[model samples]
Target chain A: MKLTDLVSRELVNLHLQGSTRDEILREMADVLAANGRLLDKDAYLDAVFAREQEGSTGIGFGIAIPHGKSAAVKTPSVAFGKKPEGVDWNSLDGEPAHLVFLLAVPETAEGNEHLKILQMLSRKLIDDEFRQGLLQAANVDEVMALLETVE
Target chain B: MISMKLLAVTSCPNGIAHTYMAAEKLSKAAEAMGVDMKVETQGSIGVENELTAEEIAAADGIIIAADKTVDKSRFVGKRLLEVAVSDGIRRPEELIRAFSEGDVPVYGQGQADAGSRLKTIQEIKQARKSRQNPVYRHLMNGVSYMIPFVVVGGLLIALSLGFGGHPTAHGMAVTPGSFWDHVLQVGTASFSFMVPILAGFIAVSIADRPGLVPGMIGGYIAANGSFYGSTAGAGFLGGIVAGFLAGYVAKWIKTWKVPQMIQPIMPILIIPILSSAVVAAIFIWIIGHPIAIVFSDLQSWLQSMQGASKVVLALILGAMISFDMGGPVNKVAFLFGAAMIQSGQYFIMGPIAVAICIPPLGMGLATFIGRRRYTKDERDAGKAAFAMGLVGITEGAIPFAAADPLRVIPSIMIGSMCGSVIAMLSGVTDHVPHGGPVVAVVRAVDNVPMFFVAILVGIVITALIVNLLKKEIPADEETEGVA
Candidate 1:
């Protein structure tokens, strides 16, 4: 159920180039797909868009957790992207999200372990100190180390 | 020890991050505020940390934050705040603070009329936990349990008489040894259990299992006129006396420092026997005769009222029936009407029939016309109340009165009084023991048109007066948890 177990160095992007919400989502989804966590990027993106339509995943504090549970997902995994320039996410606080965690969970995921990890991530994001740590982390290794502390 | 406890439910359309996030944030906020809170998360993994009935009953307030539909029925009678899931996450402290500020609306007001019977009973029991004296609490516990028996007996008796009884010079009477006669007997059997069950449960609430035998035995003695040397039995009032006496006597015996050998047998053998004997003896020798005398005297006084002004009698009966809506006062008025029917004074029962239906009918109309004054739940209950009123079930108004006694009780009392006065003035006569339009349909009522007119006037008065007295439900409460 550890957040570190759902993410890796290859999934971490310190400099995300997306200038808009859709571009950020696509960039992060590509990271998940390249890491062999998604079978069909288009289908997974559709699920994320559908979730966004109900309510935005941008839960203020400069954070957005855009997630999708679809059969197109190959494995339960998370892609971390930092857009320091900030992107509009329709957040409750009306702040652009600088830290984004694109979560991919398979429709046929075997157990609740991945969901529990997602819960831990959601809770950790609420902590001001933890968000600061995520924002200040220098590299992929630093990001992984900080996420491991969530357990 | 925490004085306040809160229950919360969190759900989202995606059933993943938001559900758990809201739960976590709420939990953290409650902890920081030093209030006990339990959050049930309806997430992707299904419901976790689900609240139990006992916990829900004991909670001071509730918060429901969900993007998707969540059942609010279970939180009936609780001070509740509902908001979007995003508000739950971003403003958890503010949500909990609403309860402290006492701004939250009580959820499911008047829902007892539309909700499940068991849930209504449970809500009543929970509501009784606060601001009630120990004696009142114990007595109410007994009454709550005794209500079903009373309704069953009352409805069955009404059914048998309505369907099979023939009006004669004496009164309504069923054929001897017939199906309806057996049904009447069955109804009587259920009525016989009412007092005993009331006493037994009261004792149980006070002294636990050891008090049951004595309470029931004492109640039986109280209800039997032979032991008390009067024509009338002691009735429910005397039953209450017996229950308290037996309960306290049993509780007192448990405090005695007995030998080890006898201590083990005290609850099962010694306590039951001694308490039962003590209660039975006390009632038979001291209080029972007085109670029976009062009961009989009250009956005689009511009978004597026949020659007096019918308006005054109708006014008194109407006030009593609507005052508590199936409580002790209501029972007295109802029994008086039933007794009058036995004496072939059908006109006395006529006003009672009208009075009995007015409270429910009036409350139903109040909700209908004053939609802004009542919550959605109350409006739903109003529909059920209207249906019950048609069938003469006065208990349908219990939820409305319970929810807002100040406005609702006075309005219903005035309504019943108006209806009863009209029925008396018109000389409406009811042959059967039942009230409502159903009795008229069964050909048991004379001047059916007047009976309906009385009810209609009463209903309108209640609706208008209650609406005038009650403030409108705030716009936020009416909105529910909008996404």
Candidate 2:
């Protein structure tokens, strides 16, 4: 349930080049699939889209957390993506999102595993310094090392 | 000598919160801007601070900020400013300034050349015409009265299942010839009228008295799927369609002029017959078939989902339940689960039950764990929401979500979805058409131990996530101003 245990270097897209919301989601799903952590890319995409239809996961403060529990997921994982120019997420504060957390939980995990991961991420995201550090990290390895302290 | 008066009306959905908020804001803004104004509030109890007919006659302009219908025929000859209730809440100062500056235009029959009065009159007329149509006025009147039935019926059935029904090998059932069976049946029968009433009022709102028969018949067909080909028929949504169909049909039929001898009969007889046939045919052939197909497909898809697939399903449901905190999307997911309960699939309800409690319980727990993160209004609502959550009322989370949708929605969704997945994996099931811990306590849920576990886990997850997501409240601000 640790942040590092769930996120991989390959899954981290430090520079996302998408302009629209759907494109960003597609790009994030691609990163997870490329890392061999997903069973079906389409299914994972469907799960993300389905969650979005319910409401945007953008929890304000220039942050968007798009997560879903899907059978396509081989294991629970988190993908961190930073948009340097910021993406319009229709945030409550009406600010573009600079930091995106894409959480992929295995559909069958038991004993509150996903919950534990979510709690860790939510806590860390609230701190301005932690958020700044995550956004300012030079590369994926630096970001991964920073996340290690969360657990 | 030149003289003019301005009259204004304000309203909101809940009538208590936003209504007063808008009224207070508008009053303050108008006073500061130095404008002559008399405001009337049409709230839940009824319209207060009566606006006299003389006031309407003399007023050069009118401002209406309301979600519900406001009678505008009285202001048919005046200038008006019409805007959403949110405008009043967020931009009252600007709105008042615009009105005082004569920025709005004249509308309706009062377009005479007072030259200076032209702009003010035009604005008032535009506001009045766009407020709420006569049809919507009547329809809302009916919906307002009809909501109590839906709430009462839904709650009663939930209560019966939770307290009186026992889990049999077949499913959750009340013992034959038992008193509880009658009570549950009565509650269900009350619910049966929901669709008919919805349609009837919609028609009555549109075509006055003549549209009733056609509307009711249309609603009945909409709710009963035998008319089409699906076992699972349309519910309240269909009622809305039927109401509009019947109203328009009746209106169209009434316009056909017959011989002088048959004129009276035409209003009573011909209109009803023609409108009913049109409504019934549309439901049976056009609208009914497509709706039936979709309903059946949804049912089959739900039934076909297996163990792992169920987890994915749970996550989607949980996320939706917590998303808007009882807004349209939340209602859709909740209603879908409730509909499935009548068809003997309790598993779908299991995840819903867990999801419902997450937001309130989570937020409530946050207050205890991190008191500095929430305002006093939120903290107070948190306690009540937690209690409501224990009984499975998802609406308990509305205050928090409304206050901060971005942070609160995702936090709650993640926690609730996690709980839903766990419940689904455990094979928990619920038999009632409602959710909440209250339903489970009454024996409505299958595998009671798992149900309790699911709810407990969901609550814990939500609390943890919320506490983590939120920043501590600033210590400098007084807690009394938190709301």
Q: DockQ: which candidate is best? A: 1
Q: Candidate 1 — which pairs collide?
A: none
Which CAPRI level is candidate 2?
A: incorrect
- lDDT per residue as tens, model 1, B1-483: 245799999999878789888888899889888999999999888889988767886799999999987766667678888899999999998898888888998875455334433343333434334334678667766765665565566566656766776655344567989999988789778778877877887888789899899999987887776787865556565677788998999999889999998888999999999999999889888986676566566566776877789899999889978987764467667888887888778888899999998988898899898888876666766776776687677766765664456888999999999999999999898887777777787688999999999999998998899999999854534532100
Worst 10 residues of 1 chain B by lDDT: B474-483
The TM-score of candidate 2's chain A against the true chain A comes to 0.93
Off by over 4 Å in 1: B1-4, B108-483
What does candidate 2's lDDT look like per residue over B228-287, in tens digits? Answer: 885645665577689889988898788876899989788788888889999999999999
Which prediction has the highest lDDT against the true structure?
1
- Per-prediction TM-score: 0.49, 0.42
How displaced is residue B398 in candidate 2, in Å? 15
How is the predicted docking of candidate 1 categorized under the CAPRI scheme?
medium
Candidate 2 fraction of reference contacts recovered? 0.00
